[model samples]
Target: MNIPKWILDVFYSYLTSELIYFDGEYPIATPVATFFNPTKNSIILSTSVSFYNKVKCIKQNPNVSILYSKHEYSGLSEKPVVLVHGSAKVHEKDFEKNNAYLSKLIEEQKETWKKEVYIKMGRELDSFIGRRLMDWYMLRILIEIIPDGIVCWKKEANILGSVDDLSKTIGSVKGDAVFAFMGEKYPIGIPVKLRKSNRKFLIENPTLNLKEGQKACLLIHSHNKYVKEITLTRYKGRISRISKTSRISRISTREGEIGEIEFIPTSKFSFKQGGILNSIRFILDGKRRAKKFLERYKKT
Candidate 1:
């Protein structure tokens, strides 16, 4: 569904006062000069020409996510909080007023930003804007986020903060997934909402010292304080891609490994062919063996 402009307007309002966190190969939490271009239907990230690792990583794998709040959870007041999942595309080139879609957005973005400038910069506001525009024409990189999904809340922040308010909070499903690769383990938090839909999980660079073409096993144990411990085992696959601090590279899309890795959260079943059935069968077979072993030995 096309996002209504009002939602875009709300997101745009936070761009100046609140900051957003960019998570991909690395996690960056910094105040950004950002604008939402209605034409491109995306949020634009502009920075100096010197390529940040993020730029290279986006090119390697476009999957990216961002988080933001009116306050950095610093206060208990309800305010706009958003989580954005999107694809990031990097652009590097000499800037022109009409060089690309970005060039057009820059001119329009400036108009809206100018009013707030005087309020922030005082007497040097004009000079500041001029310098900023000139810098835009210099060598630079742009990261445009085409949002896939968004979660926003304005009044739930305080409720989410308390441990005792365990109504919806306690009811929310969450899990800890551990992935073993390269002789180390990665503990990832899986929200209840994403357990069924999340197929690809990202392990940040240097986290487990992961590299391209490496093999790994993912163990999803979705049992938190609110729910029973359900350990889903044997989600295995080779490293498909890795986002280094410098750049990202693809490892594989479809591999020949059967029962190597699997993601079947519902009913222990998947409809896709090509060894998909074997993994489910394996899981069921493993469960039967474990149940028999428990009944014969540990049941007493």
Candidate 2:
């Protein structure tokens, strides 16, 4: 495949740059070791770190923007630059699938180079370790960078002369603006409510401090849009039914009174200053209480 020279240059420059930032936040950037052609129009660039955290950020807030430019190189007219802005998500399965294709590409390159070495050596040596080495080498993982949008600037002028000029020279010259063929520039959030369509269960108490393995009844308040009634229970199992149609009728512990509890999906809830273990405890306890209540009703 023919790779654009401008893209190659930009990738090279970015590799040596100090850092990439977003809204004063420093995002981790690693080298794109191998590129995988997953589909006819898509390519995945491998990175050093797992993008799970980044995907979480995008899911939580989709509004994201990025700018790339060379500050040190000012002599070149029409400085090479690009900006990209788009939403991102983590797809574990897709990433793994694409990485497999990239492995094949890496092997092809290695084999081509090995042939040249074999020709120079004039003979093949013992091949005992060949299979094992190849297996170990191909086990490396790769990250996939799926580009949403891109902007680019050309460096040189075309046959159109001044009209096609990208630089400051004898390029495309329009009426008021002297159009020099300038190098190509490739430039390139929101919270969504978790509803039943995305996932079931309403999280009413998002800020309560619950210990790991503790029991609590998740009371769903139907009247209030945001307020969910959570009841702390001492039992541990499954919630068959949760209602927010009326005020919560059960009270459990000092955390708060259980007014009708609403259920929210765990994926939609964000922890302000606590771990997920506590959240899981709250959910499990609520489920357990609901199961016990159902059992008592059946017995009665």
Q: Which candidate wins on TM-score?
A: 1
Model-by-model lDDT, in order? 0.40, 0.29
RMSD of 2: 23.4
**Distance from true position, residue 49, model 2, in Å?**
6.3
Could you give the C-alpha RMSD of every candidate to the true structure, in order shown? 23.2, 23.4
Q: lDDT for model 1, please.
A: 0.40
Error of 1 at 39 (Å): 2.4
Q: Model 2, 1-300: lDDT tens per residue?
A: 233555444433332111111211222221122222424323333331222344344345443323234322222334544333333333433434644555454343322322233233222212454333222222223433344444333443222111111222221111110001011221110001212323333222211222222222211111111111222111111222333332322333233422122332221222221356764564455445445544654675
lDDT per residue, candidate 1, 29-108, as tens digits?
A: 23344567777678776654332544555566665544443332122233444445566777654344323554455446
Candidate 2 runs further than 4 Å off: 1-39, 47-51, 61-79, 86-89, 94-98, 105-148, 153-300
**Candidate 1 regions off by >4 Å?**
4-6, 17-26, 71-78, 97-115, 118-138, 156-300
